[model samples]
Target chain A: MKFLCGIALIALPAFTFYCWLLLDSETFLSLLQESIPIQTQYIGLSNRLLALVPGLIPIALLMRGAWHLRRLFGLFAVRAFFHEEIAQRLHGFAFMLVFSVLAKPVAGALSSAALTMNYPEGERSISVTIESGDLTTLFIGVIFLIIAWVLREAHQLSKENAEIV
Target chain B: MSILVNLDAMLAKRKKRSRELAEYVGITEQNISLLRTGRVRGIRFSTLDKICEFLECQPGDLLEYKSNVDLTQ
Candidate 1:
């Protein structure tokens, strides 16, 4: 449901920039005077924001809802890879590991992009290179992968031992 | 992923020579029946070695390997 995030992905930065321009510097006039989206320059852009409002709330809620069920998803994944008994106990690790494998890096990229947009250019261009966020997310993903790998390996070994006994 | 046992053949070969081998194997005939039917999870190398010795057959004769293909379908 990455599309659930599409509107927020598009609008959050614009909304953030609009806010920063509105309230941050006392010099809203000069910033507004710069080449900008014509709609934003004219008004509060209320209708555009209103269009986003309905979509944003539900998507945010859905995203969190998906997060809440990650454990369930993990159990399902472990069950796919192993058996019911081992999978039930491995639910948390499986969820985190699989989630990390599948989505967290993309998530980090999106978040880092949002984070990048939040900051000012300052006297220098803000180094909001996609790589900046990608690196951290990649690190996290690898850790999760390793965790899943180690636990799964241990489980397989135990299952093998069970046969021996 | 690797060597898989055909305990059915090995057991059939062994139950003839010594009932003691069957008794000491920590498995009832019923459990052996389940194993023979390929319904077991795994086996120890020690058990495999013992079965091999009793049957006077190599482990390879008891087990075979092939590339694991998706068989769910």
Candidate 2:
């Protein structure tokens, strides 16, 4: 629920801008002419899709993982009323982390491919450099942060499983 | 790294069905089957405690430790 809400908050403005652009013709015409403000529509489509995809993925993964973990936690809840499978709990995070790291490059590659497909001419191509205020930055930042946690937990679980074995 | 769970033997001795134990432990019969076959990653302490309680056995009866045996290897 929180994840969905956060995505809504972040995506709301983009959508609002899109709506504002549509409702007000002069601003919309200016945006269309400028092309810089609307670059998000070009290369940013993938990033937008990613914000929706990845933002939702972690939640889905976490939910599925929580279901798998239900038995493990249920055991604890039934017994001491305080059961959390640390490894299983963190496993979803690890999945999100690994996905986030891979998603960016995958998104970049796909976006680049799409750009090439859409605009073959190098001069006509619409590609944005890594900028400070890019919307991609937010998604990218979230991805990086998730990856860091995933790596840490993954290593910890590996060591723990090794010890258990 | 080398503890062997003798769940099958203990369950056999207890004369308690796997399904019954599984229900009490809040795990599927497949998980109990995994335990019987010793194919689980790790059993929770709570699970071990529950199993011991159900079967009226010590942890030693349910599990055994053999030195330097790496079945996975």
TM per model? 0.35, 0.38
Say which candidate scores most in DockQ.
1
**Candidate 2 chain A, which ten residues in sequence have the lowest lDDT sum?**
A32-41
- In order, what is each prediction's RMSD in angstroms? 11.2, 11.5
- Cα error, residue B37 of model 2, in Å, equals 1.8
Predicted candidate 1 versus true structure: per-residue lDDT over A30-145, tens digit per residue: 44223121112233334324323332442343344344344445445556545433333333333443443334334333433333342346411112123345456456646655
How many steric overlaps does candidate 2 have? 1
Backbone clash pairs for candidate 2 read A165-B1
Q: DockQ of every model listed?
A: 0.34, 0.11
Candidate 2 local Cα displacement, residue A103, angstroms = 17
Runs in model 1 deviating more than 4 A are A1-138, A153-165, B1-23, B28-31, B38-45, B48-73
Query: Which residues of candidate 2, in runs, are more than 4 Å off?
Result: A1-132, A135-165, B69-73
Residue A98, candidate 2: C-alpha displacement in angstroms: 16
